[model samples]
Target chain A: MNRDTLAAREPLLLGAPAPVLAGGGAALALVLAAAAALLGRRELAAPGLEIVALVVLAVAGVAAVLLASPFRAPFTAGAHAAVLGLVLLAVVLDAAAQDGRNAVVADDWGPMVLPVFLLVLATLRPPREVLLGGVLAAAASSAAVAALSPEPLRGVAAVLTGVLPPAIAATALGATTLRALRRGGARAVTRSDAASVQEEAVARLEAEAIPLLAAVEDAGTITAAQAERARAIAAGLRAALVADLARGWLADAGFRVDDPDGYAERMTAAQRTALRTTVASLPLADFERPGLASVRGQDRDAVLELALPVAARPRRTRVAPLVPLLRSAFARADVRIGDEQVSVRVELTVPR
Target chain B: MSDAVWTPRFALSDGLRAAGLWYGGTALALALASAALVVGDLRAVAVLAVPVAVIAAGGLLLVLPLPRPVAVAAATVVMTAGATAALVVLARSAAPPASTAAFPLPPLKIAMLAFGVNAGRRRAPLIAGVAITAVTETAAGLVGPALGVPWAFDLPATAGLALVALASSGFLVGGRRTAVARRASRTAAEQDVLARTRAIARSRAAAVVHDTVLGDLAALAAIGAGPLPPAAAARVRSTLDLLASPGWADPAAPPDAVGGPVLAAIARAEDPDFSVRLDGELAALRGLDGAVEGALAAAIEQCLTNARIHAGVEGADVTVLADRDGLTVMVADAGAGFDPDAVDPDRLGLSTAVVARVEAVGGSVRVFARPGVGTTVLLAVPKAAGP
Candidate 1:
């Protein structure tokens, strides 16, 4: 899988996990900031709380923009609290500067930062986080205003104006976004599965049926040998595709396969897929023979043992290419062959 | 890294890329700004000229039309070191001419800091450069206050701000390259796997044609010459049955092996007087790869062919021994046995088909026999299940 595919696994935040949306949201905020800066071009009469407030807002804005990137380290739980801390500090500074003329919460531009802080977090966090986080943030903002402002009533009302819009936006939009993400992931999986099914069907056609079809197309006459060849190819195709017998090993394992005793979890998804493919390819059942080959091993150990009965020759040529793949995946591979009175024994052990 | 050095298209491209210019340029600009920020120290500012020029020249080389690897490295090293040394002299030697100092860093100190932004280096190297600058500037902080050095300086703020710029720029350059390198390696490994798969498929087709088509054609020739004999007919039927199996081309293990398991294959193929023996858990063979299993079966088939044609005996012994590492098969016949080494090298029966096939699957083979004694052929393979 590529980086894009790995990123696709993440849940969409507020319906904007894609690059265009992620970039657009931050760009929209930046453009708005620029517009606000242009509209209210007030000269700084003095630099005290105003400078501190600007600096805090700038830092918060940069953080917001960086957080908006689709590819990012996962945001932590305390991250929202950190944003709240910045707001707390900014609100305290703004309030201290007002000196009782009016609540700092009621200051012309002081309280505007609350919503921006919330939006930054809402767009980055999961839906449940947005829900719980929005409440905590609103309460904290109100508390900051209440504790710091001399006019508690006016302060609460002003803080509410700052917090409510973004809080609602984060909750409703966040839920919808998560739902869409879930739907997208499921749809992608379904499409991929369908494609594989079609591919397998096409491969079967090419491998078994096509040879006979090509022969018939090329030669009008069908000889007995050719007819026999077609029938054999058909049977071979069936044998390759379907195994009717139950494996003796599966019965021995005591049906403790669902959890796999930590073995399944320990392996990477790719390794697990490879294991399944290898096992499925092995000829576990033969109509003419009762027991030919089998695999038996525990997950704790790296080596997986394969016991194959030999007659005239061992099945080494067919098994050789997989050796490099196995060695790359596992720790070691060893093959041993022995002879008995009527049959031969071929054994292979691969450890990881 | 070696590819960047060797390939003409990639050579020095990372260092010379248009994106790399900003790093060196920013460092040089910061150095110049530091020199400009001095309050009333013309002497200190004058002293900044030499190191500032060096930093500018180095930064220019970094951003030039095509930056060379050797030149870029030399520039970064010389400029950073030279600027730090110049700042140290300004800090320790200058006298405090005024009581009030508005700027945090003197011109020389600022230049040292500007040079500290080694963006080509990652976090560790960038931080080290900044640390060295901070240490060098501490001479001013320690001596200026104690001995009334002429110029005023604020080491803490200057150090902190310089660290941030240097660190951030360094991280940006290093992190991006690291990500690109990781992606490149993954793609190369995947491509190798794809190529190997294609090769295996081709070789498997060849094996299939050799085993089935050629055999059938030769049988057909017999039928064309005269009526097909019973044995010939049986042979044709057997060939057809093999062709009808899935993974017929080169199956390590046949998905639909006729008659279930190894026991059945042996029972059907063995002569009346032949015997069988099994050792170890049969379950161990459960998940063997089809190709590996197919090789084992084919080798066994070859051994039986050799025995029937050359052994001149009705009875043979087959014994299977499974171990922790793998399993082994031994085919022994008590008949007119010949020296193994005496077999014609041109005859590709036991040597090429059986031995080579078994060995290919990471298995081993041993043949032991003497005149008037029994012959024993052993084959073994090892494998692991990959998810």
Candidate 2:
């Protein structure tokens, strides 16, 4: 159920597939138009308009790719408008380039190709937005032909045949798809959460202690080794519980820092584990003052600084092994052994 | 164990339906476009375009993500406009019959299909067919005398479209029903597993308490009327420390030995005051289910305690038998025994503690006892089936 819903798979839907569909549709439309122009070059009265229309459509195609890019954020209404507007302009230009030739309307790729772009638009935005844009584009292109052509009735009829049906069909199909996704997302099963935390803890403890108890039972008496192992396990279990009860390991480890916003929660389990291990590896005397830590905001990043006393003079080799681990956890990890103090600084990308 | 393992019932169907819609809708649109192109009379094609454009615009209204009532009303207005345009075109003496007949079919049917798909946003596609039938019938009636040429409504074709709509809706509904049932059954299974797990954990926790804190208390009682011995005092202090420690519930390393649960139960029940002797194939309990082991251990401990307290016996014998069907455990004692039927059902001894605990793990319990004859409790549990 985690990735079953449309909302969960939104990234996948918008990722490679969106761009492929949009780019592919735009490319095919452009290719067909270019091929038609070449095949009917002699029939084209205003070749200048045709050349300008092709260039305009090429721009729209590029814009479509950009809008559909998975790397970019969800496109806005303004971006949708701008791209569709460009396509519409090129369409009118393509029609005008036919020089009022009624027989050539079906051959004009503008109306024929417009629906493909509309379908591409459907991929990036909501169904309602795409439908609105498609309708406006269809109406304007159809009206332009009806007004500019010498044979107004044939012009309108041709534009209707090429544009309206496909555009309407695409809208119906796109809307159905979008509506299904929305309904699916709404009904997706909820995932297990903190409700299982207690069970998990109890199960972990049972797993550890059951064998020792069984061994003791088999021998009919507790050995010194077994007693010692039991005591050690108890101590370890105690430490873990204390850390959990106190909210985190940092406080129990004797480190001090002010994080009122609780940004540390954003760190994954691996990152937190690395930080705990790295700090635990260092000697208490190495710090400027034992168990002291500091945090400062540096623009968009949070900088955590741990200072070591100059007299401690921890060797470079002592810190070298830990740099990679800290670096892996954070984007920037700096360990400087200056004359005044040996300090470690880590830069964390502050979550919005 | 992860939520990713399960998939909802309708997850695939919704997508397939969408794909079908696109394929069907696109094919219809293309066919209409092709027909318009094939026709030679440009003058008639122009007149035919009116109804087609009107229908296309009306059909597109179904694509809007609007409330059901609003969409229906909007579609009505646009569809009515389209019918009016169709009427005007049919009435014209110059309009060709071929162009007029083909013009309204594609766009009107697509609109009808769209309505079927988007009806009430989630209604069955049959609703769209029903609504389209009414509209088409009305249009045919109004245009029946188009310049003395009676226009006919195609009922069979409309019925076919309705059947298509009904089939699509049935597929969606059937898939949704199957998914819901699957999800419910899986959820129930998961909850049952979780309950068994929780029971096992509780049993383990109880065993630990008996081993440590209760053992220390017994040791203290044994050293009566004097200052506690060094070892005993140390043990008491360690128990206190453990009780007060924050990580008391921390995860422990898993036990290495199999059959540990049963062995541990026998050991915990083997008190100086109450001895327990184990016999039979104890090794057979190895690799058994944790729940079965925990339940058996808890039940055996209770039985031993009962023999010591009520039966006035110093020791008991435990026998374990294992075969293909399952494992059976019997704890017998020879001493003063009371009739099991005479015991109150509410008593938290043999009935609640032993019987309920064993039965919880898909096992059964049989208690045999009579006054002065001693008592024997038999517990049978099935093997742990492979995952």
TM-scores of the candidates in the order shown? 0.32, 0.41
Please name the candidate that would achieve the greatest DockQ relative to the true structure.
2
DockQ versus reference, model 1? 0.01
Question: Clashes in model 2: which pairs?
Answer: A207-B254, A208-B252, A208-B253, A238-B247, A241-B247, A242-B246, A242-B247
Encode model 2's per-residue lDDT on B42-85: one tens digit a residue: 56556656665665566556656676567665665676566556
Compared with the true structure, what per-residue lDDT tens digits does model 1 show for residues A1-352? 1111112222211112222222333344334334333333342223375457555655555555454333233344565566556555554554544435432232223334444454445435654666566566657667766665566655565445434434554444444544444443331111112223224444655664546544543443456766566657655644543331221122222222322222322333233333333333233233123233333346444323434333433243222222322332444433343441111121222322
Error of 2 at A160 (Å): 3.3
Question: Global lDDT of each model?
Answer: 0.43, 0.56
TM-score of model 1 (first chain only):
0.46
Best by lDDT: 2
Candidate 2, DockQ score (0 to 1): 0.02
Give the alpha carbon lDDT tens digit for every residue of B7-117 in model 1: 211211231232223323433444344334432466766665666676556544433444344544655566555544454444543432231121222322333333334
Where model 2 places Cα greater than 4 Å from the true spot, the runs are A1-9, A13-15, A39-43, A185-234, A243-352, B1-387
Residue by residue across A259-319, what tens digits does model 2's lDDT show?
5444453344334544554454444464324455566674346877766445455555344
